[model samples]
Structures are given as structure tokens and as C-alpha cells.
Target chain A: AQSVAQPEDQVNVAEGNPLTVKCTYSVSGNPYLFWYVQYPNRGLQFLLKYITGDNLVKGSYGFEAEFNKSQTSFHLKKPSALVSDSALYFCAVNYGGSYIPTFGRGTSLIVHP
Target chain B: DTAVSQTPKYLVTQMGNDKSIKCEQNLGHDTMYWYKQDSKKFLKIMFSYNNKELIINETVPNRFSPKSPDKAHLNLHINSLELGDSAVYFCASSQAQTRNEQFFGPGTRLTVL
Candidate 1:
């Protein structure tokens, strides 16, 4: 079974400061990792995904994540945080054997101006 | 145009009642999935259909059934719902079974009293 973990339930950052939301996972085979963001009372929006190529993948809204094979970590990062960036972020993984994506408990990000 | 859409943004009913949530995607994707997000914001996949055929069915109980009448539409019907069934249900669609990036519809919040 594939499982993803987000250690922090919430993360707080100030505007103009860099922010990082950590995620880790375990899978039986090659893993497909993804990041998604959800606003209040809304559906999740796609952020980025890592399938096979580079370790760093850039996505919408100037966000990026780095996939570390040795550490089994895929952390979401942004150079600067904005108040509008506050939302619930989720990490998901799909084990190579199955196409179903398993999601982790989301992390609530709060950006202060 | 809306990529994915779900009806009855809010649903409240008694524990023993039956309810249905309809979903449609205009993205012309082949695979659609239903996922439940609990109060704690943990998301779990319940079912997935591809090309109007059942593809992935998780350990969900028999009371919850998903019907895909066509590729563009997938609806979920719950029978004999319980308090534990109260959660936010999101419908998402992707290009294919192997695609990880999914476009999600506004979730339907089901509150079973």
C-alpha cells in the first residue's frame, strides 16, 4: 500500500518570507507524488506533480516542490509567501502498481501580512 | 468553462435517509473519481470510474454506491446513511487512469444527523 504523511498540521509564515510544507511517503514501487491546494469551502486545485523526470518541479502560482528519493520527501516551497496563499495543502502518492492516489492529512498554511 | 462541477453544494438529511450527489466534468477526461474528506481534512478515495466503467473501488461500505452513466457524468448515491458518512465529497477528473493531475469539482458537504 502507498501512504503519504504531512508532519505539520499547520504552518505559519510571514509575507515576503519563504515557506516550506513538508511531506513524506512510502510506496512499494516507483511513486507518483502530487501537491494540491484547497481554499475554504472549495475543491482542491492542482499544484504540481512528480512522475519520473527531474527532482524539482514547478507549478501554478509560482510554487515548486522537490522530490528527494533518498529521503522519501517531497516538500512544497515558495520563495515568498502571500496572504492569498493561505489554504489547506495536501500531499498524495500513487504507487506504481495502482493508479489510485492516496492522500495525506492536509496542512493548513497561514500567511500573515 | 467549468472543468468539473457537482450539484447540491450542501446536503443535510437524517441518518436513515437517502441522498445523491451529481457530478459532471467538461474537460473531456477519461477517468473520474470520488473522494471523501473528513472533518479532520484527511481525504480518502472511495471510487473511480474510467470510460463509464468501474475501475477502482475502495473498502467503502455497500451503502455508498457510485454510478457512471456516461464518460462526462458520474453520480454518487448513498443508501441508509449514517453519522459517520457526514463529510465533504469531491468529484475529480483526469485525462486517463495513469494521469495524476486531476481537476476537482466544488465539494458537496453531506451532513447526516
Candidate 2:
């Protein structure tokens, strides 16, 4: 069984500052990792994914995530934060041949302008 | 065009009433999924269907049943609605062999009183 853990319940950052949301996972085989964002009263939107190759993956709205295989972590990052960037973030993981991805409990990001 | 969409963005009903949420995807993806987001913003996968075939079925209650009429549509029906069932339900789709980044709908907020 695969599992995802987002240790933080909330993260606070100021506009123009770099932001990071931590995520870790446990899987039996090669893991497929992904990040998603959800605005208030909205569904999640895909941010980025790490299937193979480069450890660093860039995604929509200048968001990116780094897949650290040894650490079993995939952390989301952004060069600069904006007030509009505040939202709920989720981390999910799936292993080989598994159609189901286990999701984290989510971390709420608050970007103060 | 919306890549994924769900009907009845908000549902308010009393306990014991049955309801259903419908989802559709226009991205021609081969897989669809249903997820429940609880009050704490935790996302739990309820079911997944690939090519209209049942693929992933989580430990969801028996009252919750998912049906896929086709590869593009997946509907969730909840019987014996309970207050514990009140949560935001999301529908997502992805192509299995592709990058597998899920596209999500706006979500349906179900409220049982």
C-alpha cells in the first residue's frame, strides 16, 4: 500500500517570498507523484507531476516540485508568492500498475500581501 | 472548454434522502475517479473506473455507488444520506499511460441536515 503525508496543516508566507509545501510518500515501487491546488469552494487543479527523469518539475502558475527519491519526498515550491496563490494544496502518490493514488490530508497555504 | 465538469455544485438535503452527482470529462481520458473531501480538506478516493470498467474501489460505505455509463462519464449515487456524508465531492479524469495528471471538476458540496 502507498501513502502520502503532508506534515503541515498550514503554511504562511508573504507576497514575493519563496514558498514551499512539504510532502512525503511511501510506496513499494517507482512512485508517481503529483501536486494539486484547490481554491475556496472549488475542486483541485493539477499543479505538477513526477513520473520519471528530471527530479525538478515545473507546473502551471510558476509552481514547481522537486522529487527526492532518497528522501522519499516531493515538495512543492514557488519562486514568489502572491495573495492569489493562497489555497489548499494536496500531495498524491501512486505506484506501478496502480490506478489509485493516495492523497495527503492537504495543507492550507496563506499568502499575505 | 471545460476538461472536467460535475453537476449540482451545491446540494442541501435532510438525512435519509438519496441523491446523485454526475460527472463528465471532455479530454477523452480513459479513467475517471470520485473523491470525497471532508471538512478538514482531506481527500479520500471513493472509486475509480478505467474505460468504463471498475478499477479502484476504496473503503467507502456501501451506500455510495459509482456507475460509469461510458468512458467519459462517471456518476455517484448516495443512498441513506447521513450527516457524516456531508462533504465536497470531486470528479477527476486522466489517461492511464500518459502523464496521469488528473483534471478535476468544480466539485459538488453535499450538505445533509
Candidate 3:
């Protein structure tokens, strides 16, 4: 079985400061990791994905994630946070020959002004 | 234009009642999925269809049935709604069953009283 985990239920960062939301995964085969963002009353939007790529992956809205194989982690990061960037973040993991992906319990990101 | 869209953005119904949520994608994707996001923000995949064929079916109850009339549409029908079923239901799609990033519809928030 494959699974993803967002250790933090919530993350708070001041505006203009860097923000990081941690994610880790467990899979039997090669992992295809993805990050998504969801605002209140909205569906999730794709942020980025790591599928046999460089360690660092850039995504929408000035966000990026580092895929660390040794740590089995894919942490979402933003160089500078904005109040408008506050939303719920989700990490999902899928493996080869699998049609289903397992999503982590979301992490609420609060960018305080 | 929205790449993916769902009908009935909000639904409030009594327990034991039946309801249906509709989803459509204009992205010309070949796969569609249904996911349930609980209040605690835990996301679980319920069903998946590829080109109108059922491909993935999770351990969901028999009361819940997903129908994909075509490659562009997937609708979920619940026979008996329960309070535990109250959650945000999301519909998503990917280019194929491969490791492509998914596009999600603006979720339908279902509340069973």
C-alpha cells in the first residue's frame, strides 16, 4: 500500500517570510508525488509534481517543492509568503501501474500579515 | 472557461435521502475520479473511470455508485445519505492513467442532516 502524510495540521508564517509545509510518503515502488492547494469553498488546484525529475520542482503561484529521496519527503516551499497565499495544502502519492493515488490529510497554511 | 466543473456547489439533505452530484471536464482528459474529503481534511479516493470504463473502485459502500456516461462526464449517486457522508466531494481528471497532474473541479459540499 502507498500512503502520504502531512505531519503538521497547520503551518503559520508571517507575510514576506519564507514558508514550508512538510510532506512525506511511503510507497513500494517509484513514487509520483504531487502538491495541491485549496481555498475555502473551492476545489483543489494542482501546484507541482515530481516524477523522475530534478530534486527541486517549481510550481504555480511562486511555490516550489523539494523531492528528497533519502528522506522520502516532498516539502512544499515558498520564498516569500503572502496573506492571499493562505490555504489548505495536500500531498498525494502514486506509483507506477497504479490508477489510484493516496492523498494526505491536508495541512492548513496561514500567512499572517 | 473552467477546465473542470461540478454541479450543485452545495447540497444539504436529510439522512436516508438520495442525491446525485454531477461533474464534467472540458480538458479532453481520458480519466475521471471521485474523492471524498472529510471534515478533518482526510481525502479518500472512492472511484475512478478511464474512458467510461470502471478502473478503480475503493472500499466504498454499496449505497454509493459512480456513473461515467462518457469520457467527459462522471456523476456520483448516493442511495442513502448519512451524516458520516457529509463531506466535500471532488471530481478530478488526468490526461491518462499515467503520472500526469490532475485537474480538479470546484468541489460539491454535501451536508447530510
Pairs in clash, predicted candidate 3: none
Full-model lDDT for every candidate: 0.92, 0.91, 0.91
Residues A19-106, candidate 2: write the lDDT tens digits: 9999999998899999999999888988999999999999999999999999999999999999999999999998876888888999
Q: Across residues B1-113, which tens digit of lDDT does each residue of candidate 2 receive? A: 88899999999999999999999999989888899988888888888888636865647989999888888899999999999999999999988753488889999999999
Off by over 4 Å in 3: none
Best by DockQ: 3
TM-score of 1: 0.95
**Clash pairs for candidate 1:** none
Task: At residue A93, give the lDDT of candidate 2.
Answer: 93
Model 3 residue B47 lDDT score: 89
Model 3 vs. true fold: TM: 0.95
Sorted by DockQ, highest first, which candidate order results?
Answer: 3, 1, 2
Instruction: Give stretches of model 1 more than 4 Å off.
Output: B52-58
